[model samples]
Target: MSIAVQDLEAQVLGLPPEDRARLLERLIASFEPRSKAQEAWMQLALRRQEDVRSGKAAMVPGR
Candidate 1:
């Protein structure tokens, strides 16, 4: 189920202090992009592209 931002904020505000902190942390973590695997793959792809552009690497033709 989707929640409105205002509603989520209100609910979080009503939580006990420690609970609120934990909830906020979880929410922030959930919204963050770029998991470890994705970051690694992105780095690898960028390096490959650079290598190809600089003539340091070449693509093999597919059969």
Candidate 2:
């Protein structure tokens, strides 16, 4: 990798967990269309919702 990219990677890697996650969110949004990602998420959510409703799955309480 080029020096500039290496430096950037190091800086990104140094970010705190939350900062890194937020950065990742922005990176994905930049490359992926909002509607496409939203559609995928919605599909997964609906399937999970139906699973619980149909008694095929159950929601676990978060600690």
Instruction: Write down the TM-score of every candidate.
Output: 0.46, 0.50
Segments of candidate 2 deviating more than 4 angstroms? 1-3, 36-63
Tell me the deviation in Å of residue 31 in model 2.
Answer: 1.1
Q: Write the per-residue lDDT of candidate 1 for residues 1-38, one digit (tens) a residue.
A: 99999998898789899998888778786887878997
Best by TM-score: 2
State the C-alpha lDDT per candidate.
0.91, 0.92
Tens digits of lDDT, candidate 2, 1-63? 457988899999999999999999899879977687799998999999999999999999999
- Lowest lDDT 10-residue stretch of candidate 2: 28-37
Query: Stretches of candidate 1 above 4 Å error?
Result: 1-32
Question: In terms of TM-score, how similar is model 2 to the real structure?
Answer: 0.50
Clashing pairs in 1: none
